[model samples]
Target: MTAELEARIELAQAVERGASVLSSRVVEAFLNVPRHPFVPAFYRRDGAKYVPTRGHNDAWLRAVYADDVLVTEVGGVHVEDAPDCGVTGVATSSSTAPGLMAEMLDALDVRPADRVWEIGTGTGYNAALLCHLAGAATVTTVDRTARLVDAAQGRLHEVGFAPAVLRADGAGTPPAGGPFDRIIATCAVRRVPTAWLEQCVTGGVIVAPIGNALGGGAVVHLTKLPDGGGGGGGGGDGPIH
Candidate 1:
């Protein structure tokens, strides 16, 4: 078997063991959507500096599918732009661990045609999974960073998915769109946004990490009710790290 496929299969097994119970569809999505395409390069901390890792070698491919968070941006600079000697900064964005991603996606309960709105487009890996679960045309993902949005859009398009990728604040109102069937946030928020609630259709699901959920290290999966109340269920505490 090819190295990528082998690594991904191993990752799938690890995710099933470490994260929440995944459905057949979720498993298929994990196996089908290769993580390396979305994260062309990532940072690995070497002492105080963050070194960039990029290549198509065996070790590189293994790390990409290792169920680990790949830090793509550090202090607003993409890893690809960093020097060989590396840079020192706080990680601004990353391709989250596959286990955490699987857990959240399983909680999202995406259907074939469900209209999905994703809060953080990060490496666009999660967005690609959403496209695999739902349809590409049914997904809309937004991120505040312009460069990240552009990179994500290009990577996603390269992989044959063309969801609506926007460079807008996830917490703010975008141009009239959605009464969406599902909304998922890959980023941490202090509280669930009122705009997100308003945009979701009644009975729609919102899977997000908010407030002490992360301190408790968990994600909340809420269903919108006709009365505009949410019926929440807790997903596994699969931390991004």
Candidate 2:
């Protein structure tokens, strides 16, 4: 096998071993989904500036397979569109680390026929993984930034998975897709959006990272109760253990 593929397999196995109870489907998705295509170029913070991976060289490939978050956009500028000198600003979007993704997917407990609505499309990696678990037709991902959404759509298509990728605000009303069986957000939200609750079917699952003013965060796994309210528990300041 090629070195890159070997590295990817090792990374997937490491993630699987680290998880307490990751489903087999989740493990397969992690092993097969190509993370490099989704994040063609990412930034490495060098002091005040962000440095882009020069090319798809050995270093870039190693970083792609690493169990680490990759910053793809900073200060509204995507790494692919940034100047050669690099950009300076807060990171606006990123590819979530594989370990965290596996935890959230485990919490979601996605089934084969489940219809999932993903809030943040970012690199499209998570959406692709969802498509792998739940058929592509049942997966829909939305992002507020048109550029990011468009790029993600193209990348997903390149990977032969074409789920519904839309450009809309995830915090607002859910997309016109309909009541979904699962709703997940890669971005941090201050509170669970009521629209998300309203869009999810009874007994559906919603997994998201909720942020607090104290700079702490938690991954909340809420189930839509019969009364259309959320009920469940959450893990604080770390991956759901």
Candidate 3:
């Protein structure tokens, strides 16, 4: 096998070990999904600027296989579009850390027949994993940015996944595919959207990172109840992370 492929496998195994992801399905998804294609270019902070990887070589391969989060966009400027010197601004989006992603997916507890709605189609990486766990036809992913949605759709297709990728406000309108058996948000939200609760089947799981005003957050796993209320582990108040 190529060294890069070996590195990716090792990284997946390391993430599984570090995150304690017990589900074989989750582990297999992590091992199989190619993270590099989703993040063709990412920013590496250098001083006050965010520099893009020089080229897709060994260094880039090493970075992609790493378990760390890679910033794919800064201030709405995608890394591929940024100047050589790099862009400076808040990170508007990123590929979440592999360990954290595995944790959240484990919490999601996806099943083969489960229909899933993923909110934050950043790199299409998480959505790809969801497609691996469930079937691609059973997964629907949405993002607010049209550019991101378009790019993610193409990349997902390249990876033999063609889940329903849409450009819409995930917290607002419910996509036609629901009521989903599982709903996951890669982005943070201050409050759980009522639409999510409405779109999810009763007893379905909603896993997301919830932040608080204290600058702290935790990944929460909530279950939709028969009365339309949500109850699960962890509690915090802030935007979804």
Off by over 4 Å in 3: 212-216, 235-241
Evaluate model 3: give its lDDT: 0.84
Instruction: Rank by TM-score, highest first.
Output: 2, 3, 1
lDDT for each of the candidates?
0.83, 0.85, 0.84
Model 3 steric clash pairs: 187-241, 188-240, 188-241, 189-239, 189-240, 190-238, 190-239, 190-240
| Alpha-carbon deviation at 232 in model 3, angstroms | 0.3
On lDDT, the leading prediction is: 2
lDDT (10s digit) by residue, model 2, range 43-82: 9999999988758888889998888878887888988998
RMSD of 3: 2.5
lDDT of 1 by residue, 91-138 (tens): 877777888788788888999999999988888888999999999999
lDDT of 2: 0.85
Could you tell me how far off, in angstroms, the CA of residue 135 lies in candidate 1 after the best superposition?
0.5
- lDDT for model 1: 0.83
By descending lDDT, how would the candidates be arranged? 2, 3, 1
